[model samples]
Target: MLRNWQEVLDLLAIIVKIPAALIMKVEPPHIKVCLSSHSHGNPYEEHEMAALGTGLYCETVMATRAPLLVPDALADPHWRNNPDVKLGMISHLGLPLVWPDQNIFGTICVLDGRENHYSPPFLQLIQQFRGIVERVLKQIYYDEVRVHEEAAIRADDAKRVRLEFAAIRDREQKALQAIKESKQRWHFALEGAGDGVWDWDMARNTVFYSKRCLELPGFPEHKSLVDFAEWERCPHPDDAATVLAEVQACLDGCIPAFANEHRVQAGGGWKWLLTRGMVVGRDDAGRPLRMTGTYSDPQAGRSRLAGTERPPGRTGRHADGGIAARHGTDRRHGKDGLAGPPGGRCGPRIEHAGGQYHPVIVEPEGSHRGYLRARRRQAADGQRAGRIPAQRQGRL
Candidate 1:
């Protein structure tokens, strides 16, 4: 019935078309059939375990790696006294259940109601049945290996999601919890998140802004990031149109999420940044009413092109011994009186859009940065920030 050894064993028993079939494998104490399609065969004791020993059917099949067919179980003097016949089996056909490795580990058998049922056609039928048994054996082995692989994958992905949720959930407290937690734990995510963390409430028609967010051109402070056109305010002219389009899609009640990483002005030149905001809460109609995510600079990612640090921006060490960004726009005040590359302003290497990573960039003010969207602080009612995070500190 099925190419699966587990299923084929049970199917062979009552194939009314074929008197009886049994599927048995080796263990230790006795020859026990795992699956039987009809009541004509033996079902071993609950605690019984099978073994490949002196048992005729099992031993012969295991030793010769072939099928044993006897059309008349009672008349054959060679096997008449055999336990199988003594047990009242009148006729029987046994096919070795061989694995892909050519190991005869079990048997698929059919018992007949009459003598001499082992005709050419019936023998051929048993041979055909053997084909199914062999394949099912192979599949059983394959399924075991496949199961291991799938379990490994599930474990790895679950670990990643678990960590991500842990981080995101950290934002439950202090309005600035996301910033404090990142600095304390990852310390490098700021470099990957790009700049200007923001929150948009589609239903309330309000958007929350941060200091660095105000620095990005497309949106103004204490006011809507859009006024007939939000694109004009975006520092990166190239990405403005797409950003606006994504914004509308996120707010249209069609899609409850939006995320984009593109270049934007940071006091001077364009720098890469990752912005992620998802609907933290939704309405009855499945519409997104609120969203929140982090925004940080990604200078370190830009520096590690091809694992070769390209000397860009300017070279001045932070008081904490971090390199001053040599490229891109960095408007943050530095101890050396130079604007270092803005932290978290570099996007992911190439087009790798999704991944949680943090690169250590120490700021003079005692903060580190990287890219990661961990859990937000647990709101008394379970909510996120009412304002954006503070600017990058030391370890740049």
Candidate 2:
């Protein structure tokens, strides 16, 4: 931990009793002193640079990738002309510093003014210090690499979270938009039809009546009806049983639709209502979940045909594919449909047949004068045959 390069060099200078000790770093075509000793008469300074290819001790050690020793540079012919000898540094010894990849880093070396020989202990001490410097360089490299890798991982995670959040937000927006559009369409349909609408939640036995529905029965628009029992009370007593029975048949799956003509008590008098509805929702068990329907008044059109009539014995279909003569033909009978007595009310009645209710609008009757005269003659013949008394014959 106490591996400061200058401190190591200073301690080395004292232990070896040398005038100069340093760590030099190699830059292409030049070498610089990175750390220098603080010993007295030490001529070298830290960060000093000199050209390579010169006869400098550190440069030669780096070039050879081995240790260099000159006990007395002035006396050795090979080192006699070395630049350091002219500067009064005649003794030199150094070991080359190599990186992990075998590239030369520089040299750790010492110089002396007097002639000296570096012993084994002095050489080993400098080698151990070199190992410490290399370890520090390796640690620095590893820490820098790890910092970059962790930063990249954090950036990737942030990007993924942003994408997922955007996708979820898009889906939520689309769902809300769809619900808004559906509600708008529903309201538009209700406004245009002008029919009294009702929704019944069959599972809860609760009903929700629209403003039109409440108004149709001469009730205030602000009144809320939540119970089916209350709705049952609104219909005329004579028609309530028939209406409920038809509705029940639909709920029980015996009929495809609930359709019936009934009367309800209004503010003025009884109002005829043509009620049509069907089960709109179902559960997994095939039970009814919800039902919806509309209330319409057919009297507006029926009033237009008040005085219409048909010719005698002329039975044919109306434009609506049912008998046109309402006063005479009873479709419940076979062909050659029996005509009711003249002036009798003969509107189609709602009846359950073949698992559903159907309307059979009948043809109107002939002239009342002809039908009544024929009826009286038939009663006289019955009295003459003694099948009826004279008093009963008079009533007929």
Candidate 3:
């Protein structure tokens, strides 16, 4: 485009019979020859510059936003000392180029080496080219604005996408944190209640046991079972079949849940436990996907039934106290010589003596039924003798 403007300057210089034809561009403090005619004897060179405010020909045209004609610089006192004299181009005729918004671009002009008045035809030619230059400036300005607008639109789209991804990530993190906290709360609650919690993943065939669950079976706190089969190994042989059947029934949707009192091997003996569980998740085909449950020592109820209290100074003992008391001995000869199965289902004798009700262990030689019958007869005899209250007789 600049080469084409050079050609235009060359043609104008030839047509006007001038030594120089130039396009001057303003750059604040100075104006430079942006293009110069290639004609012979044209002293001005492309990129030649002169400081503004120095009485230059182009400066006057730009300042007044109008044409400038200097017919004879040496003859005019106001123009004789201008910088163009050093180049020996004293005759000047120029027109200002302006943008569509009327801002000055610069001047397109012809300069001669001798005194000569520029003709009307020459002036008309300079004016026509000035209009062409201003049109090109307008087009360049609008093109740059369009490029900047497109860049800004792209930047906004990128910013929106980044913000959307950030929002999604933040939401996911919050949801995961909530799930973790919920599990912690459930774990603390179950452990506080003295229950051993368990979770079975049917698809993975894996069983996860809580710390209490491991402790219940005399396993190390850090011990981990690999699968449900390993957990099944903990149940007593006699109870394993029944326990598995009850669990399968729940999994098969035959029962709402599995609740069974069974024995599990712990230490060197067996401890009776009440295990309750239900299928918590299932597939569309009704097959169990996950099961959760808890195991609790059932001996606490038996201890209460026998009117026993937790022994003083025995902190952290199981609520039952029976498991610890019967640990290294036969259940028949357990604490206080309690005669019963390992579960403590029966054989502890309750008697109202010394003004308080308490349990007394009966010898295994006596049948449970015979002992109850003899106690009833003794209670009736006491009532007849006025030794027992009528209200207490019913309790006996």
Candidate 4:
């Protein structure tokens, strides 16, 4: 746009046959030559400053918001001392430029070395050129305003999106942590119960077994159990069909619960297991979605049926599936058949050694008083059951 304005100034110089023509920019206390005509003998240069002196043509035009014309500076006493006269420009014509808001911008002016009157047509032409420059300035201002508005809107949207994504990520992390904690709690509870727990996803025909459940069937300790068929193979051949029938009855909603006594292969031959389960979850149409159960190895005293004397490393079972020594001697070598402290489920077991029945407390070392009290209580219970010797009765 400035290039086009410069071309207009050059054409003005050619049309008016002037030595100099300029487009000036009003900068408060001074006016600067923004563009100068390319005509020969033009004294003013582009970007040169002209002071706001009393008699300069551009300054007077801008002060009045009107045009200024002087046919000859020497002939007019008011303009005789003007700067243009000292520079050999004796004639001048200029029109004031204004913004759309009517603020003064500057002037478009022509200077000549000779005295000459500018025609009316030339004056009108300069006014039209001034209008074009004002319109260009207005368009540029509006374009910059639009660009700034769009940039502000984009920045606001980006900030909102970032906040939303951060919120979602925070929620996901919290949910994952909660799931991890829940799994740990469930595993702890199941292991503490000392029962072999199992879960069956009926819809997928998959089964899950806990560590205790795996040990009951004498399978190696593992974290996961996938194949239901493999679990079916653990039951003794004689009891498998009946157990399956009972479980199927419960799954079909024919029984209140799945309850069955079965034998499963164990570390010490087949051990009797009392298995119980129920449908814990159901689909919308009443089909069982999931089933959970427990395994109880009820053969604690079954070894007594083989003989009156129990072998070493073999745990003895009582009439009610509890552990007790009938041979006046009991010993345990591993994690099995041991309970710790009063808060734990497994109580102390009695061991007869060196002519006396000593109570074995499964707590940490250094519990002599508890052991003595347990022994006294065991002696009383055994004497009532007629299992203790009369000579040892005074030991209580």
**TM of each candidate vs. truth:** 0.34, 0.41, 0.58, 0.45
lDDT of 2 by residue, 349-390 (tens): 333355433323223343222344445677878743222212
Please provide, for model 1 over 1-396, each residue's C-alpha lDDT reduced to its tens digit, 9 standing for 90 to 100.
333644554454534355456666665556666666634444332234545454456567666777776777567777776666655666777767777766656776666556745567656766787786676668888898799999999999999999888777665565477668765454244423445555655444456666565644333455434332232244343333334434444444444555555555544455555455555776776555566655554453441211122234422222122122222222233333443333323211111112211122222221212111111233343665343343442211
Please report, as a residue range, the 10-residue window in candidate 4 with the lowest summed lDDT. 387-396
Tens-digit lDDT track of model 4 for 1-396: 888998898899999888898888888677899899999998888889866765677878888887888999999998999988988999998888777567777888889999989999998998889889888877876787789999988899899999999999999999999987986687678667656778887556678988878876667766356766666666554344345544555666666576555566676576666677777888787766788888766554342221122235333322232122233323322223332233211123223355322333333232323334445667878743222222111111
Per-residue error for 1 in candidate 2, Å, reads 4.9
Which regions in candidate 4 have their CA more than 4 angstroms from the true location?
26-31, 49-64, 70-86, 99-105, 173-396
Runs in model 1 deviating more than 4 A are 1-19, 39-54, 147-396
Candidate 2, which ten residues in sequence have the lowest lDDT sum?
Answer: 387-396
Report the lDDT of model 2 for residue 9: 88
- Minimal lDDT window, size 10, model 3: 387-396
Candidate 3, residue 13: Cα displacement in angstroms equals 2.1
Ten residues in a row with the worst lDDT in model 1? 348-357
Candidate 3 local lDDT, 100-133, one digit each (tens): 7777888898899998798898778778888788
TM-score of 1: 0.34
What is residue 244's positional error in candidate 2, in angstroms?
A: 30
